[model samples]
Target: MTAGVQATVNDASGDPLGAHVALVIVVVMVFWAFLVAGLMFEPYRQFGHTGRLLQLTGICHLLTVLQDSRSWSLARVGDVASILMLGLLAHLILTLPQGRIISGRRRAAVAGMYAGVVAATAVSLRYGPGFDAGCDCFPPGPELSAAAQRGLLYGSAAFFWAYGLILGGVLIWRLLIRPHPAQRRSFSLAALTGALTIVGVGGRLGLFVMPGTPAPDGPYAVVYAATLTTMVLGPLGLVTVVVRARMHQASILDATVGDQGLLPPSELENALATVLKDPTVRLTGHPPVEPGRSGVPLRIAGDHVVHLTYSSALDGQPELIRSAAALARLTLRDDHLRAELADNLEAVRASRARIVQAGDAERRRIERDLHDGAQQRLVSLAARLGLALLQLSRGQHATATATVTAAVGELQDALEELRELTRGLHSPVLENAGLAQALASLAERSPIPASVMATGERLAPAVERAAYFVAAEAVTNAIKHSQAQRITITAEIRNARLVLTIQDDGIGGARATGSGLSGLADRVAALDGRLTVTSPPGRGTALVAELPSPPHDLR
Candidate 1:
């Protein structure tokens, strides 16, 4: 009532939804932006490429354009923001070639062209024209119009962006309509971000080109009353979104996950296979991957031996070991209590492998059952029904009457059962509709209460599969081990990777190595993924797994 009254009795008139709500959205958005800088660090970071960061970036950028945007014009900040945005976009485009998938100069060249525009514009502002004014893109006086080519070039870039947006919007439409795309990984981050930037550009200027403008005496008059607001805030939105991507990646690396690039791939692989894979390896870091693959194969040298305290609490008094011994002891257990924990660890490991194999076998068995059993029955039944109908039409009514009626009804039931079986066994919706929908189905069917959230605009099949399996495993574990009430599963795709997180509020003291969670980590690692289990004795268990989102999505 208060809001309605204030709006009704307001002195100004304009777009209430557009101006007022847009302004509030902007304020809320700007405030929400603190999270992104923590997520976008490096590829291997813990906080890297997350969903919240991505969403915040997009929202905050749009919010800056709502009202009083022009007053934001400050010294070199705008230029720096523009440069960072252009660099980020250019990096995205250029990295496609570096990723070795594109293997062509075309995309890289496009990146260079965009970067060149930034450089040229910067140079023109400094030397070619209006050198006295600071790095502000918008000037208040008549002298600002003197920098003609800079404006034209900048405007042209915006126009190109608008074109890209139009083209991308079409692609988004296509993906949505025929979402069960035959191909996956066809979509890229570069494409999504570019499309968003284009949308931002066109949206900011869309009103002017419309058939008619809202009366200037309306609510938005307060919003557009100052030219600086739009000029500064409009483009800032795009910049914020892109920069936020970087921040997200950075934050993850430092806080959540370490920069594994510090170790060579082979070495890190060995370390994980050796220490981390050990079923008996308590909450410690140490191991030998395989029987002969131990002692750091001559080929694998480096080690990032971050301390891992193994069962120090329940078991009491933790022991520390060097990189090599830690790796060995962590896996095989070389201490006095090792014998006691051995059976438990082995059981955990065995259960982990068994669950994985059983899941696969179940799927195969169900598939075979359908193919060999129900399908054949349906085919035969269909033929029998058809033959009966033919006989009845040919004036053999008495002969065909019972058989035709029975066969027809049987066929309908068989088909329905097959459909139900299929839905339960494996979802075609998951395969065709993609991971997000598949997870939604899983959440609905979860015996234990569960909530699932998917983050990517689009996902590759491998990623979708990884996410599906991870959630399945997590939920299964929650039911069998944790005795938890609710499980929350989140799948976020960012920078060619998918991070799967499953958490439950249940009994504490759940050990990853001794419980189903340890095996879950091993499974993820086998697929070149990483898993982290955070279960403080009394706190709820939080499980996180990171899997490589294929550079090329194969649907």
Candidate 2:
């Protein structure tokens, strides 16, 4: 560290006449080196462009040292280099934060400045001396006529002045009007740097337009001081801009990382806006879909309206946003994914609890049905048969026969009730006849006119069972509550999963958390399948179930 300081001190005093310019160049070079090093190790490149501009801004000042030297060739080269540097500075200020040109107007401005610089260089090469009289760098060249020299030099001057004024005006306008605090700060700094650099450099270049005039020697110290001051201040302002931008981004990430999965949508939006320094950030969600969707939701960030396209980074991963606008997008996407996972976990817990509760309730219902319906009938049948035997012993044959007939009828009713209870517990038909036949039978039995469209060879037993139960429950719910005229059931194998959909043309107000649908969801969940219910009142109810095929079934 001591050695580094000593090196810096030596560099600053290397040329006493141009000491300040040398120091400014060193400071900017050091800033650039650190920026590049950080960019190499850091994952984010939010200030990559700004770093490059600072480096270029510093390198341009090297020509200042060259302008002071006695070598005519070096001085001529320095003049042309300075012209190029002016254009570069304009380009840098106009395209801040992000390095690339943003709008057509800014693009045209940069293009015009570049064209002006090129024209100026071409004319200077044609008219100016290639070398001094005693120098052996190049053969002496014929000078252009005074008229031609003035025209070329004056035209070039006009170009530089125009670029400086236009760029400075734009920055000033932004500083005055832009509502965002960060943007206003950027514009303000840029305007100050631009004003200083333009006035200082443009003034120096203006003197060269007159034909056969030598640049001032010593009395113009004020001009040299102004030029050095602007060069020094420009990089300092840039350093501040880079630091502030990085801090803003880091603060946003810190706030977000703390709340991770807990922020409600509104708070999340606010957090994002605060971090991005854009008060107008918005987020939107796309529901899970089959065959997927083509587009992502629309969100506005600062001055840019972005359509976050959906793409997956890897197989079996959730779809992620494709955005290049800001560093905040990375954190924002991560927070969203974390929140979604949290919600799904909560839903799974609730589903499990409901499943346990529903299972207990179902067991009690079965017990009650047996005790009230079949058990009572069986007891009555036993009593009547006993009476029949007693009457037969008393020789009343006709009465005994009538009692026996009544007993038999009671026995048959008891058998039917037990069979129904058994069917409810586990369908024998579904076990024996497979999915298609069972669903067909279900459609046949429904009170509402129903149709079944199932097409698959055979799925895993668990998958088939889950699919069948989903269809059965949905149909029963539609028949009982929907007051519908028609029901449609569709089952197909898609992407190695059994997909089933049940729709009813009735009053549509079914909720996934409702008792009946909730139970069906548990059944589907057990098989690692998902069930979604869409019921719009007065429109229709649609229930969809997707069950993954077991490994053997896939084979």
Candidate 3:
């Protein structure tokens, strides 16, 4: 009985220090599971599938711990469960960051891993010993024939070594090579954890398979320590990655708030790309319709104004995308307003310059008209008068009388030319009698059969002058350019504005930019008015000028 007790004690305490360490590790893992599970809850609730995978991975680790138990039934159950969960671990690793499997190839690979693990577990259950006789902690196996037992041991061992190597190789290949720069650190850590797990577990399995290997105590303990370290670090690493990602999202949102300046389209896109860590990010006026492309609509005041397109890497975090889009909408709106204000200011500057230039040209034209017309006529009249006085002094009565009569005719011609020039400058009739009578005078002077219909209401001097000039310019254009038979001018106060309309039953091709019409438009615009010309081919021409005409007291 004493000898039996000694044997039992030796079996139970093969590696006391290692057992104590493993116990501490198990306790740490338990605490870690609760802590990490709490952290993963939100991700799971929001993105259900990813959280589920993480839960399954945690379960697999728990079963892995159970596989180290001294109870035979518990060890056997844990071994089978852990083997079945290998595929889940692979699936979780491959589909990290993104919760769902995106590609068919990866899905098929995970499915194949599951099938292989099932087949391997079935073969072991059917043909292999349930427990290792050399280890007191291992579970008992089914009674099997010697040849069948050997086949199970060698085949399962070989398959598992290949499986571990393949899984480690695939994890490293998928995550380490050309991984997204933003996710590189997480991928690297996950890859390192997976590689360490495979090495530690595979090395321990290799020790058991070697010929003439003694009971696994010294080297087994070292392998076990490495395995426990990896298990502890794996979940911790994942937690770190998740926490870091959350912080990253927060930082991005904070950065957007800091960018309060008016950002141009290109600059806005660049800033968003920088914040999202996606160079493929773009801001577009319309939503993207291409395959593999996703867009977030940015709405302002319940109206969708623009779209934000980004890489699919950001698809996992819809909250982040929405927040970014809201901020982008504000930036884009401000940018548009700033651009419009700049354009308006530039247009005003250009309009003022054109007005000044037109004024200078008009002055030069008036000077030329006086020099070539009234001035010449006046000079001729003076010469004729001087000649008439000379004739009178020489006692030539008949010639002097004829010279004075010619001088009187020349003086009349000069006065008429001066009146015409002054009329062009600012019509006295418009100032004295308002727009209605001024339009009547314009129509009467027009060569075509013309009629005037106007309300006799007085208007602001500037408005009346603008309306009169619009009518005069329209009449002149119609007479000079339009082959019209009849012209109509109408002026009235409508909706607090002086509405002047001129229609001609003539050739319908008057351009608003024509020399006479352009000047008229400028005159109307100076008083905050608008001039519209409609002259479609084969249709009669019409000119409508609208000038603001408030009540006299308001003006």
Candidate 4:
């Protein structure tokens, strides 16, 4: 076990560069397979050519890499293989998307490209200098001068890339003139692939054209680097095209599933037509007929039709005429009841949320009434008690003076307690002014130094009440239990929700289930809001609450 653990650690700490390159190569191979699979399974036969050519291209590139493992003399065989692949690529580009060649002239041009590659490879094997010794004895071979061999190599390189440039021009033209959006997307991918391959070709041509110029690396190195880069990116380009096509298909399916029951019958027909990609799609519901005599018929324009029969149990029900799209019947059949139930469930949830909000509003109203009415009256009573005590203290009734003073003190205490209770219930500032002012009042009243940072448009009354209560409870708990030096309350409105957070710098370990915090949570819940308290040992407590706030226009 110890040795295994040490080995695992060593593997985990292995050189990252080799691991990364391996991962990239594996991903590229997977993407190559995905692209080929997407093409091979395409619905149309016209795309078969491009898919087959790409398959050949992938094979040729793989062989090129494998050639590096062979002896250099044997590796020369890959030259013609590489040239044939490029010729095939040119053909693929010229006839992208629907891969059938458009005209005889275009077909002839593709044939000429392949012919040129074959002739050049033949010339190189015959008249050109050989890489291995066995070729010295071959008969009927032209013995070319070194300079002539160099010129032949340069000429071949130039011709190959010039053909590539022409193919690139054809791809660009197709992209510009293609009328269908789907075909244009495929053309775009073909164009990008062509461009990258052309760049690599141009790099090779550069070496041939400048024999006297010193290369940054050896010829083989530059060619291999360019080839590897194209191999990696070409698969990615094809995969992008495949992904986009699948996404478009998925969107159609998604629309069918989502809007089946929502649209009117005529509108639903149009929607189905869009999803099925057949504009002629229509629906015609029929009255119940003899159970087996004549069933429902589903037809796609210019395609074979299918008849669906109703069971004896469903004989009395109206016949649903589903769209020709596969699975459309399943979506449309008996969906009304499900849609109605869904709407009812949503309405119930909304109603419950409103009731919770109304409770919070009622609480705020009571708090406001208590503060402005009864609390004010009590304040006046406290003033009267103080006046009576002052008068008795002046010696009008010496023995009763002490009793009045004590009673006056008690009244003063009651007034203070009432003020605390009203603040806790709901801040008068929150009702009249806004949440910011209420939070500021809270910060001022907190035993520890506290600050309020709030911004954004004023929220609804219920939202304000919920936020105020949570902040008050959190502040009270933090000051009472947490030996905090300071507290901070932050409030903001975002995406029509009021987010309020309170934090303290003190000994932590506050629990959400504590009576004060739990009651705060209940108040928040009554407003369809959420409250969370987070405190860890040695980390100060924090409380966050989120409340739904309708738009100002809505309010």
**Tens digit of lDDT per residue, candidate 2, span 402-514?**
99999999999999999877765577777787788888988998889999898746777778778887888788889889999999999988887888999999999778788
lDDT of 3 by residue, 1-555 (tens): 222223233435785555545454564473466347435644533343556665666666566556657797787777766675566666765565555677898788778778876666555544444334344333566667767667766776676677777777766775566455665664577677767776555554544443333353466555655665665566555565566667766766666655565455666787788877888888887987877678988765446468899876566556667768877888777776787789978867877777888889989989999999998988999999999999999999999999999999998998898987887668888888877888888878778999999989888777777777678768878888889999988888888888889998887977878767777777787788898999997788999999888776223
Compute the lDDT for candidate 4.
0.60
**Model 3, TM vs. native:** 0.51
Rank order by lDDT, top first?
Answer: 3, 2, 4, 1
For all candidates, what are the clash counts? 38, 0, 1, 0
Q: For residue 26, what is the lDDT in candidate 4?
A: 41
Query: Which regions of candidate 3 deviate over 4 angstroms?
Result: 1-49, 63-81, 96-99, 126-144, 180-183, 198-216, 243-336, 345-506, 512-555
Better of 3 and 4 by TM-score: 3
- Identify the candidate with maximal lDDT: 3
lDDT of 1 by residue, 280-362 (tens): 33222454443422232221123534233322111100111233333433333233235557876885677667668766876
Candidates sorted by TM-score, descending order?
A: 2, 3, 4, 1
Q: How many pairs in model 2 have backbone atoms within 3 A of each other, for residues 3 or more apart or on separate chains, i.e. clashes?
A: 0
Candidate 1 vs candidate 4: the TM-score winner is 4
lDDT of 4 at 506: 87
Worst 10 residues of 4 by lDDT: 313-322
Q: Cα deviation of 263 in candidate 4 (Å)?
A: 5.7
lDDT comparing candidate 3 with the true structure: 0.70
Instruction: Indicate the TM-score of model 4.
Output: 0.40
Kindly list the per-residue Cα lDDT of model 4 for residues 1-555, writing each as its tens digit: 222223223334574445344534643463475357446535435354666777666666445433233465546546545566667766776666556687898788889878876665554444443322234324655567868767876676566567656665676666535424434554466457656655565445434343343333456335535544554555556556556555655654566555334443335566655644435444545423553333456442334343444333212112112222344454444354566679868856765666677567768867786678666666666666666677777866754565566666666766677777667666779888888888898889877999889974577777777788778878878878899999999998778778899999888998877656656776677676778888998889888898877776326
